[model samples]
Target: MKMDCIRTTAAGLAVTLALCSPLVAQTATETDNDRLDNAWSDIIEGEGQLLSPTQYAALNNLAFQAAAARVCDGEKLDSEAFGKAVADILVDTETELTDNEHMQRNAAVLISFGTRYGLFVAEANGDNEKDFCAVATKLKAEPGKVPLFLK
Candidate 1:
């Protein structure tokens, strides 16, 4: 009788672990995504003060890939258009980013990220150009809906 009880407890524990493992992994992924999203928002909104170069690089890479995945199709990435779109979404006319060099740097970051992410997602999704373009267009039109799209 004691052996049977032990076996049942072990079985229950195994079942619990099996069921919870995937949820834990999913939760971790969601948390990471949220962190990345927040970082991107900060940078775009000009709150990325005193961030190390490595941190900026990571954030830039993540943002670029995510944005590219949302916005670019299989065609050549139009960096200028992407920069303008991002500027429209994140920058206000009243902001003090008047220097051409600063604006250009931001634009370059966007283009680099977009290009990398676009190529990656395109290849990963079997190069479905039509779908890629459609999704990219939708994302560009509604940048605020990125979290929903990511999910």
Candidate 2:
């Protein structure tokens, strides 16, 4: 997590979130359940190429969530730094993005990240922590599908 990029991403996210999506904004037609369903649906849509704006947004958030979760679970290897690293992967500002040249990507990350974080915290119906730790242990073991952050 470079300081310069963090600053740039913060500014970009602030502007985008402020102008495009209000954190508390809700339509009369859409309920909280609807939004959650939409978020989950967006995640399902992410299984493909993940070209849709909704999927992109959801993935960004899932990045933040996964990074933060590993860090919070006391499996501290290098995952502590990864929460900030999500911004770097959020948008390749260095490259000429013809497909996503116009819109700000950091804002989508912030919005989706916050939403998923909330959802993760609100989940109390199951032993998610135990399940998450089991997966973390496997990733940390041989096979090693997950590289950095879960060690």
Candidate 3:
């Protein structure tokens, strides 16, 4: 009888946790995502130079992605696609500087920065262009979707 009660109690507890875990997990996920998003928003709202250490690496990821676009695109960099990417990642239009001159200048600065990083990626992958380009192509196929390599 004691063993039966213990089993029932354990099962009830498991069921309760299973039901409640999603709500708990969802809140945590949203909080973490919002934190990163707010950080990005703040960065975009002001001068874009990144100064502090950050747990979110997406800003740094721009360099690698930009480099991949530049080096792996072969004959010409897809400026349109890359520009869209830069805008999407680096600029928060709502918070971005309203002055046309400053906005353009900042955009240019980010492009130049990405180009520099592209050079770095290219230099580092001098012998690995084949593989790097392949990955870049895969990413381009599904802009926001998970890459096959990730799955």
| Leading candidate by TM-score | 2
Worst 10 residues of 1 by lDDT: 16-25
How much lDDT does each candidate structure score? Answer: 0.40, 0.41, 0.43
Task: Provide the TM-score for each candidate, comma-separated.
Answer: 0.28, 0.42, 0.36
Model 1, 41-141: lDDT tens per residue?
33334422222233333333344335445545432445565455445433433346668956765675555455435443543355344443454445445
Mind sharing the TM-score for model 2?
Answer: 0.42
Distance from true location, Cα of 56 in model 3, Å: 8.0
Off by over 4 Å in 2: 1-39, 42-73, 77-84, 93-103, 123-125, 142-145
Clashing pairs in 1: 71-136
lDDT of 3 by residue, 1-151 (tens): 5555444434432332233223222333443322233433333334332311120133333454556655665523456654665565445433446588556756665654554364437443665566555545655554443212211
Model 1 TM: 0.28
* Residue 13 shift from truth in candidate 2, angstroms: 23
Error of 2 at 74 (Å): 3.3
Number of backbone-clashing residue pairs for each candidate, in the order shown: 1, 0, 0
Residue-level lDDT tens digits of model 2 in 10-70? 4443343333223212221232322344544454333332123333443333443364354
For candidate 2, the lDDT comes to 0.41
Winner by TM-score between candidate 2 and candidate 1 = 2
Ranking, lDDT, top scorer first: 3, 2, 1
